[model samples]
Target: MIRTIPKPKKSKRHFLWLLGMKLMISSLLIFFFMSSCTKEGTISLNNTNDNIGAEIADSITVRTATYQLDPLPANGKGIMLVGEMTDEATGNLKASSYFRIGNSAISSVTLPDDAVFDSISLALPYQGYYYGDTSLTQSFTLHQVTEEIKLIDESNAWEEDEKPVFGSGSTLFTNNTFRYDTNPLGAISFKPKPTSKTDTVFVKLNQMFGEDLWTKVKSGSNQVTNSEEFLEYIKGFVLIPSGKTPALTAFPTDSILMNIYYSYTRTADGKKVQENLQMKVDDTTHQFNSLQIDRSQSLLSALKPDAEGELSSDQTKQQVMLQGLSGLVTKIQFPYLHEFVNRNDVIINKAELTIETPPSSHTPYTAPSTLNIMLADEHGVPKSLLTASYETTTQAAYLVNDLSGGTRNSTYTFNLTEYVSNYRGAMEDTKSSLYLTIPVSDLLTKADRLLIAKSDDSLPIKLRILYTKY
Candidate 1:
């Protein structure tokens, strides 16, 4: 509820140790939320105050209230590579995905004039960066994406809770367990010379598929000439893990491709030699890693959305959940702004939100370096704080830093002054909500999440609003 303050004073970073929050405002909802709110009710509003420059004798009212919000909508997968990983610490989350691969035009132009097919292998250059324990063995299995490896971005089907079905997908490649160890799989990865660190991981595919590919190449088929034609013959590959390991993020098919090894006979002066040939990845085609996340075992899985769009207290009493890829965002609303409207014009000098990381009793995870937020829209789309930089962090809604947290307060704080200012500007029209999340900005389509404290905890989520009423 909106607590009253007598008079006001101020406040004010680019430091890291991210503390996060997000939201927007509309007048109508603000009234409904902020009305009937009272804290101690000690500071009295002046009886004669309808004027512009009314003297505000009392100290500034600082009120804190927490609002529950529905989960955020899924983000469109824009990254290039297929990022798959399961984190036991992060709700037993697992990512299963598939994508189409095409032969590079350069290599596809024509097979060796006198070439014969040998063996085929799928090469995936590891991006080198992984979220969980890379040292641990992560078993992976690749299947033939027999069905068209369609991109889900073209339709709204991806928005649903369940992932899109590759539809009767078939595995051309036999299901084999490829184990990922400290020295992950790659031709160059495990070289004895080991002059440089290996960044690529290779998985040899079924030889018959390569034979089929070579068959088509010998027929002078268009499949060898263009990716569009090649995809028709063999759609793509569906990647899944044998057992759950934290995560394995791979590069795009551009860096990752199916190399069809072949050999040609050459007679050099009286000696015969075997020469090698390869069919590389068509860098033009874009392969995506669409993630289907399983959150049943994670901390946030306990949270179930209520029918009426309300968050369950028991389900989310003490923790703020930021599930990655699966799109679970913490929604927060300021429900006491109407109390400020009832009195008169109040200048919200600074309204900062501080969310503390629940200190771990057993083991503590690394704090997210940067927390991000965006305005929550009723239509399931993202809205902004309506500020100069709502879309970017240049003028973000929330951030946690030592500067704001007194350099030692392990909590993060955000200036909600803009939110309050908009509310006062359009009293009856002010209504909006904030969606909190972990930012994903990679072709690997990978990011870690935050699971901090909520309002019901001993150290409840706080919104400290400093306002001066004139």
Candidate 2:
């Protein structure tokens, strides 16, 4: 036999309703006080409380992981990056730029018999872009490509969102490389002056190499007469940096020129006249930077080049990383979010995320000026970029500078109110994680990187939420 209990009387029910009202009023006051202390922004609500509750929480659990992105398309971007560096964050890193050279002026070129070839040199103009230590002297060698600088045709290489804005065509990626002669044509060592617009570094080629090309032009060889044959003979050029460089530098592809100098006797006056021929970089579409990153000596060693996987922040010393130029990106997730989903009593008002950098993380390198946050699938592939409220533009988190001596003051923050509200109503399977990456415009041209501390008490990442319960 079981005993049944009777329902409460009307007076008692009324008393409980009054009690809930009191609790709601108290919670509202607490929430308001906390919000005022934060001084970030104001929270407003109706003056009357009708059986409703409010909550302010900053203890939400956030998970973080890091993974490598696919090879980035590096062709026709107007910038050529070349360098080599070794650091604990990215391990041994190397960058090389490959591009073909051609000149239409050579089509009608004729040389006199008395003309004598002078020295030939390659002129590289800097674009004021650099990473790592510029105080040290940087050294690199110019090599001749043994094979043609050709691109492989891939019909389905780019996804809809990953397609380049410049239009679609066969392009080269950071992982693509061409065979180059082991012997370099020329090499140079100099202190970098990236910010000087008028400064140009010139590397003189071997006399034999210059004379061979000079002789060909004088004899009107087929190799020097047509673009097709010219490319077949000279192939292309690759800028390879010595392993000793601690910085990566960028040069404008269009400004690169190969100059051939010569002197000829004037038939009428017998005066010696000097002249030079210029060969500009050809087919900007086929130019690309080949990047190689070795993580064997760093925390990311577990990430294999041939495998797709992610390493948790716990496994990486409670930190996640985001790097440009096909390097790495961080993923963020809320594991216990399901506990509050679909709750009829709760109404999420605002959600803000803050990610901080570790101490000394900015010593030798500066963090990216801005970062883009995107919704990502389980495999870490970006699905859609998170956008501003009621706007079609993608949202970006700008880095806040630190005035104090401490490096931890620098941070990246995001407004995730819309996402939080949607997550509360969406099905568990449809919910996605957030990915923090460098801006798309910087991926193939810049080597900016960021290191974010994982979420924890007194740590680098935090999420705060203001909500109401009814």
Candidate 3:
């Protein structure tokens, strides 16, 4: 048997009577609270910069996950010999980059008839950047590319959000290694007092190899006649670390020249005229930096696309990781944030997010210099957060001096007042998650990562909100 439902008709008089009752009740309530009203029917808002006597306040721990970003720029920032590091949160990271430089001379590339190769030195100017411990001496190997290190033409340039693929071109070179102390072992003199971020370094290359190149130039070889032939003859340079240093990054550009020093006896006299031919470095030096991360050793390495507990109620498996060039970020979500859904009359005085690291995490490890909290898509691409007004004005982090030496100052507290206030009705649209990552800098950024505190951690992550329920 089938049953049919009937529609009931509404009367205009009954509707008018119900609306009148509601207005009367509202008027009476307004009159009762008139003493506390700023407007005829609205309560007055008291603003408190700090959390003071909050009428409605609560805290919650959100879920977090690591998000791997796209491939970093191939050769723009500089050279890299990133040492390996393994942590429970950030996984394993090892970045090694390759670069290709060409002859600077336009034409008339010549050598003295009696010029005898004395020595050659690779001079590298500093980029004012370095990572890892300077306590240990490090070694970086230089290789010659057997294949052309061509530039990515605009036609072949990857999309803005596209991650690049890793390429290991067949490069040829005799063994050339640079071994040096990262720090001065004895007294050092500098006209400007060379800082850790500045100064130049030199590595002596094989003189025999330098002579071989000079021989080719004098033999009328195509390699010395033209830039294209030179690039084809001596493809490019690549840096390979010995893996002894914890981590290291070096910036090498065309200015990082190979100076060929030789002496030629003048035909007029028995005098020796010493001249140095410098390999040119200019805008034509096409370069790229590539990062390789081995997640096999990472504690969060097992996370999968369909992994459960990513944002679980218990919060054991969820984690937030941020690394600059390594291309990783963390996604976050406060499931219960809807509790503050439509607080139209409330004033969000303060909303601070405190993230604490576990005891198991490495201490004294240099954290990311800066960070950003923004909305993210399913692909982990970041978007602007209209509510994160203070994200720019506020400092990314502060020094929590632990002079007393306890757990009081080990946490990273981010001011999220403007961000939380922007989300007054944002939940309806952002039903999925937000993200935490290093500020994007058009790939000019460096290698840095931070591991946020998870729920299972001793301190865990908490979002403390202090608002006035006017």
Give the Cα lDDT of each candidate.
0.46, 0.78, 0.53
Q: How far off is residue 426 in model 1, in Å? A: 1.7
Instruction: Please report, as a residue range, the 10-residue window in candidate 1 with the lowest summed lDDT.
Output: 167-176
TM-scores of all models? 0.65, 0.85, 0.70
Better of 1 and 3 by TM-score: 3
lDDT minimum window of 10 residues, candidate 2: 39-48
Listed per model in order, the count of residue pairs whose N, CA or C atoms clash below 3 Å is: 27, 0, 7
Q: Pick the candidate with the highest lDDT.
A: 2
Q: What does candidate 2 score on TM?
A: 0.85
| Predicted structure with the largest TM-score when compared to the true one | 2
Can you write out model 2's per-residue Cα lDDT over 1-470, one digit (the tens) per residue?
A: 89989986679888999999999999988886555334323453223233345566678888888877667677899998888767686567789999888856566787788889998999999989999898999998999999988875656667666543322577777888899898989999999998899999898888899999988888888888888989889989999898587898889998899999999999999999999999888678778889887889988888864334678888988878877885577878887765664677666766788888865676577888898886777545666788974458988999887777764458888877777767665677533677788886686688888877643357677787767665
Order candidates by TM-score, high to low: 2, 3, 1
Q: How far is 254's C-alpha from truth in model 2 (Å)?
A: 0.7
